[model samples]
Target: MGLIAEHNCSMLLMDHVPKLLVSSIPDSQVVKNINCGRTKTAQIIKMLKIEAENELVQQLTKRKREREREREREREREREREREREKRERERETTKEEPEPAVTKKKNYEVDLAILKIIDEDSAGVSGLDMPEIFIDFNNSSSNKLLLLDEITEFSVLVVSVENDLEENILTETKVSST
Candidate 1:
């Protein structure tokens, strides 16, 4: 108030207030300390933001890798199962050569059940800021806890989208066009 009254210039009040205060303060050390503190605060906030982003990226990559590894392990199990079945059939054929011929039958492949990944989104508004809610595979049941979201963090989704297979010759063969 004193600085503003003395200066008699209230134009761009916010921009002038800091300068006026700095000018009024006799000690340069005080001004330097204030500027240094502001700079440090800004740097800390920036570093925190960067760290948060890096952590998110790392988590996403880890989830993707785990899913890939699990899929690969499942595929390998199926392959091993098929190989064992083939080996048993070969052994049976060799031993039953002297026996009477049996009726031909189709062999059934082993079927495995897959678990569906679900994300609990209590909020209707999933989109926050410019970035969309990141899709994550949460195996644990989150029924007991409430969905928490911050300004930097949004809700999780399953990332389901509509897709159609378009053949290469379809455009030329069908001649799809809007009138």
Candidate 2:
């Protein structure tokens, strides 16, 4: 019998080898099949097993990479949330601080008296001829004796009235301290 050198060989595991010498080529006539020569069939089987293992390893690696990426994204989102919460807390704390009020006051005093009596009451032992400008300081807390140099001014006016007018224009000049 002549061996067909161009034929492909493969192995088929069996419980029993055929006792009779059948045709050398398989019924399928494929390059690799279950009924090929022993040596070539063993090599094909090894190659198939290695390929299956390689495919499984590649699938597992892909799944791991996807899971790691998702975990990284989750960590980044958590950090951002923490930062936002801190910013909000800082803003609320700043808003809770009380604002300062302006520190100033104003008072108005009205005086209608003779200028010489005011000078006599305010200035003592200072002759009227030597008086230029006199200022008075009072130590008493009496309301009747309380005196203020500000809120005082002199104005001269002539009366003029319109028919059925119930309003009067009164003008006074005063030195007032204000903020």
Candidate 3:
């Protein structure tokens, strides 16, 4: 195509460009650049002098090599970033191994808390899985009048049960089940 364009031969403008260049002929940027705007039997652009043409072609090849090198550099940068991320992850794992695990305070599960003045027999502290705060439900379960305090069980049925209490280690007895 370059030779044809150089000799100012007629060229047919193809929109789809089914056939770019003949295998016998070297690819030509000038012919490739032509599009639907260029018509068949049109006058081709004049080529540069031999020395100038060779110089321009060499410059174009150099620019192509530079672009390829730039792409390779960008790929290498991305690879380095990936390695840095992996290194950081490894450092985090190593620190985790060296450092002690965070102490997890055992959560007490209390269904209700009976702050009684006097018990039926001995004044023994009856603890259950339902510990104070979240699970401690204050209820008047004692048969004795000596017990005095706010009964939280009065606010409807608080649904005191062994629900979610995985461990039977703590004695969690409801008002109905309490002896």
Instruction: Point to the candidate with the largest TM-score.
Output: 2
TM-scores vs. true structure, each candidate = 0.31, 0.38, 0.34
Q: In candidate 3, what are the lDDT values of residues 34-142, reduced to their tens digit? A: 3334443233322323334566688799999999999999999999999999999999999988968775432222232333221221213555523223232233454
TM-score result, candidate 1: 0.31
Q: What is the lDDT of residue 142 in candidate 2?
A: 38
Tens-digit per-residue lDDT, 70-160, candidate 2? 9999999999999999999999888877565864332333222212113323334655533322222221323435344443333322122
Better of 1 and 2 by TM-score: 2
What stretches of model 2 exceed 4 Å from their correct place? 1-35, 98-179
Candidate 3 lowest-lDDT run of ten: 114-123
Clash count, one per candidate: 0, 1, 8
Better of 1 and 3 by lDDT: 3
lDDT of each: 0.41, 0.43, 0.42
lDDT of 2: 0.43
Question: Where does candidate 2 have its weakest 10-residue lDDT segment?
Answer: 13-22
Ranking by TM-score, best first?
2, 3, 1
What lDDT does model 3 reach?
A: 0.42
